[model samples]
Target: MNFLIRTNWWKWLTMFLLTYTVVGGLLFTVPRLPILNETIRNLHFHVPMWFGMIILFAFSVFHSVKYLSSKDLVQDLFSKELINVGVLFGILGIITGMIWANFTWGEPWSNDPKQNAAAVALLIYFAYMILRGSLSDDHQKARISAIYNIFAFAVLIPLLFILPRLTDSLHPGSGGNPGFNAYDLDSNLRLVFYPAVVGWTFLGSWIAGIMIRVSLYQFKKDSE
Candidate 1:
């Protein structure tokens, strides 16, 4: 009973928050500007995906660290599951961002620094997966994969943040638009934006949790 209740509570919250985000984001009052126009609503959808990806990847790294410390296969499984969901979120983020860019930026694949960095970051993690596939031994795979996870995350942080800031980019808080943050999002957008992040992250986590459980079950069954 307790287990069911605990699991259902966050699931309910994820649904509620996302429902509110979708409806409110489209219909709710937003600041009107020249370039952004109605597309500012993408904040509720597109941006959260990146946020969710970061959150999911952070958890993946956490589990990776744990795996290194304890050498537990379960930890490795959790880390892998998180990366899987993180990549899904990254793909969603990139697709949605391209759609948004086409309307506002006049080009879907403009050479935006931030976008380039994001693509590179995903590539880095994909490489980690490839590295895992190459190693059949579980112990070697776990240890090496965890190390790569940590390194990829370390590089990812700077690639997303520092590198973008150093170059001219269209993303907020970067490039020639030093004052972009001031004009980027107002309080009204934030009301939905913060919850959107939480909701999306929670939902990503829920999806990862489901994947982890199913995989673990399959592993157990195979073992038995």
Candidate 2:
């Protein structure tokens, strides 16, 4: 009972935080700024997607490194599950951001540097999946995919974080551009925003856990 209860605590927390974020994020009071206006409310939902993606990708690569070191198929499975969820989040982030941009900037594809970088990152992972599919040997697939995933994450850091700042970007907080009041949320947006990140990230983990279990079951059934 204790083991079950302890292992599942974060699942409960994920549910609670997401409920709070959904209820409060939609109805909560937010700063009224020019250009952003009420769209700033997207900060809670959209931004968290990227945060969740980053967190999941980092988790993915960590397990990938473990797989490389130990050659454990379980670790490789975990890594794949993490990247699957991470890519889902990344796709959601890009779509939502594009919608937000379309409303605010009058075009869905503004060729914004940040958006381009995000697209590139997603493409690299898509290539990773393709590479994985091409291999017939499980061990060889795991070894090569793990190495590719590590490199993808390494490039992702700069593409997602550094490169945007180095160039002129329409995204908030790039160069002289202030991010919708420059993180000075005055505690209004942060309340929901922080929880949104936590909620979405844990939710991704929960989904990944389900995928991992299913994969393990299939692996076991195949072995038997």
Separately for all candidates shown, the number of backbone clashes (residues 3 or more apart, or on different chains) is 0, 0
- Please provide, for model 2 over 66-144, each residue's C-alpha lDDT reduced to its tens digit, 9 standing for 90 to 100: 9999998888988998899899999999999999998898898998999999899999989999999999899999999
Clashing pairs for model 2 are none
Q: Estimate each model's TM-score.
A: 0.93, 0.94
Best by lDDT: 2
Q: Model 2 Cα displacement at 210 (Å)? A: 0.5
Q: For candidate 1, what is the total of clashing residue pairs? A: 0
| C-alpha RMSD of candidate 2 | 2.6
lDDT of 2 at 64: 93
Model 1 per-residue lDDT tens digits across residues 1-224: 11322467889999999999999899989998888889989888988898899988998998899999998888888899899999999999999999999999898999899899989988998898899999998889989999999999998998886788787777645644443374467888888988998999889988888888888898788779
Residue pairs in clash, model 1: none
lDDT of each: 0.86, 0.86
Global Cα lDDT for candidate 1: 0.86
| Residue 42 in model 1: lDDT | 88
Q: What is candidate 2's CA lDDT for residue 132?
A: 96
